[model samples]
Target: MLGAGSWGTALAIQFARAGRATVLWGRNRAQVEALARERRNCRYLPNAGFPAGLTVTAALTDALDGVEDVLVVVPSHAFRQTLAAVAATGVALKGLAWATKGFELETGLLPHQVVEDVLSGDVPTGVLAGPTFAAEVAAGLPSAMTIASARADYARRLAESITTDTFRAYTSTDLIGVEVGAATKNVLAIGAGISDGLGFGANTRIALLTRGLAEMTRLGLALGARRDTFMGLAGMGDLVLTCTDDQSRNRRFGLALARGQRAEHALRDIGQVVEGYYGARSVHQVASRLNVGMPIVEQINRVLYEHVSPHDAVAALMRRPVMAELV
Candidate 1:
C-alpha cells in the first residue's frame, strides 16, 4: 500500500487477512508513525484495527523491502508523484498495481499511462478497481473487484495475491474500458447524489443512473474502450454503488452541493477527496475533446465548475430535446 488513506488502510487489512505480511506506506510521516503506534488508521479508517501481520511504514523503501507485489493506493492526483518516487527508488518490483480510480489531473492520463511514463522497466502492472468501498472491505464484508491489465498474467498475479474469501477478484484485459468506466462513474455519482439530495423519487434516480451509463459508454467507446466493459463490475456496477451508497464521498459531496453548501465548504466537511468533484471537470474536458455527446456529464460540469444551480441543471437536463433512447 502506498497511501494511508481510508482505501489504502482498508486494502492493507485485506492483504494481511489473506495471510500476506503486508507493509503499508504513506507520505505523511506523522500519520504512518501513528498507524505504527496505534495499529489502526484512526484518522482515515476509524474503528478498523490493523491486523498483526500488517506493518505500517513511513519509509517508502522500507515498505517495498522484499515485497512480492506492491499496491499503489494513493489518490489519483498523487498517483504520478508517488510512482515517480517509486521509480526513483530502483527497487525492481515484481508485480505492481494500483487501486486508485481516477485520471491524472494535469495530463488527464490513466493510471497505467502514468506508470508507463514514470517507471523504467517492464514491471508487470495492472489496476484493482470495482464498486468497492474502503469501509466495507475493512469490515471484511463480501466484496467483488475487477483487475485489469494489458498482460493477462499480470492481472492474474495481482488477483491471486490480493483476493480473499471475503474479497473476490475478477480479471479483464480491457484496461481502457475498465479505467474509463472507473474514472467516469465518480462524475455520474455526483449527478445521482444531486438528484437524491433534491428529494427526487426513484424514477429520477434511475433516469440519472441509466442515462449516465450511456454517457459513460459513449465516452468509453470514443476512447477505444470495449462497449461490453461498461456493463461489467467496473462500469455499471461501480457506478450504481457510488451513486446510491451514502458511504460514497462523491455522492455525499453532491448532496452537500444540493443542500446549498459551497463546493469548498462541502468538501472540507466531507474530509475526504471527493473524486467526483475533481473528475467531473476532467471528464467533461475529455468528452468535449472527443466530440462525444455526454449530456449528463455536461450538466454535472455546469453545476460543479460553472456554478450553475443544481435545480437549473436538472431543469436543463429535463428540457433537452427528446430522441431515441438508444442513441
Candidate 2:
C-alpha cells in the first residue's frame, strides 16, 4: 500500500485479516512511526487498529521490497509523485491495482491512464472501486466492489484473492466505464449534499439522484464504456451511498457550501480533501471537451468555482430546456 490515509489503513487491515503480509507506507514519517508503535492511525481513522500481521513503515524502499502486488491508495493528485517514487525504486510491479478515484488535473488522465504512462508499460494495472466506506470496511461490514482490467484472467485472479463472504468482488473488462463512474459520482454526491443542506425534501433528493445517474451514464457511454456498468456498484450504488449518507466527506463539504460557507472554509471544516471539489472541475472540462451535456456537473462547477449561490445553482438546473427522459 502506498498511502496511509483512512482508506489505505482500512484496506491494509483487511488484507492482513486475509493473512497477507501487508506493508503500509505513509508520506508522514511521524504518522508512520506512531502507527508502527501504537498500531493505530490517530489522525484519520482513530477507531481502527492495525491487524496483527500488518506493518507500518516510513521507508519507501522497505515497503516496496519484495512486494509482488502493489495497491496504490493515495489521493489522485499525489499519484504521479508516488508513481515517480515507485519508478525510482526499480521495483518490478507485476500486478498493480489503484484505488484512487479521480482524474489527474494537470494531464487530464484517469488513474489507469496515469499508471500506464508512468509505469513504462511494465506493469499490469487494474482498478478497485465500489460503494465502500473506510469506517464500515474497517469494522468488517459487508461491502461489494468491482475490479476492472483489460485482461480477463488478471481480473478474475484479483477478484478471487480480494473476495470474502463479507467483502464481495466482481470483475469487469470495462475499465473506462468503471473509472468514469467512480469519478463522476463524487461530483453528483456534492450536488446531493447541496440539496440536503438547503432543506430539500426526500422527493427532491431522489430526483437529483435520478438525474445524476443519467448524467453519469451519458458520460460513460460517450467514453466507450458499457451503459450497464453505470448502473452497477461503481456507479449508481456509490452515488446513492455517498450522496445520502452523512458520513461522506464530499457530501459534508457540499452541506457546508450550501450553508453559506466558502469552498475553502467548508473543506477546512470537513478537514479532508473532498475528491468532488477537484473532480467537479475535471468532469466539467472533460464533458465540455467531449461535447457531452452534463448540466448538473456544470452547475456544481459554477457553485464551487464561480461562487454561484447554491439556491441559484438549483434554479439554473431547473430552468434548462426540458426534454424527453431518455433523450
Which residue runs does candidate 2 get wrong by more than 4 Å?
A: none
Please, what is the whole-model Cα lDDT of each candidate in the order they appear? Answer: 0.89, 0.87
Q: Evaluate model 2: give its TM-score.
A: 0.97
What tens-digit string does per-residue lDDT give for candidate 1 at 1-327? 888899999989998998889999988898888988889988877888999899988899998989988899987888888988888888988988888878777887888888988887878888888989998999999999999999998898777877888999999998889999989999988888888999988999999999999998999899889999999999999999999999999999889988989999999999988888899888888888889999898999999889899889889989999899997
Q: Which residues of candidate 1, in runs, are more than 4 Å off?
A: none
Model 2, position 178: C-alpha lDDT score: 92
- Can you write out model 2's per-residue Cα lDDT over 1-119, one digit (the tens) per residue? 98999889988888887678899999898888899888988888788887888998898888888986888999899998899999899877778888898888887788888888878
Shift in Å, residue 104, candidate 1: 1.8
Model 1 earns a TM-score of 0.97
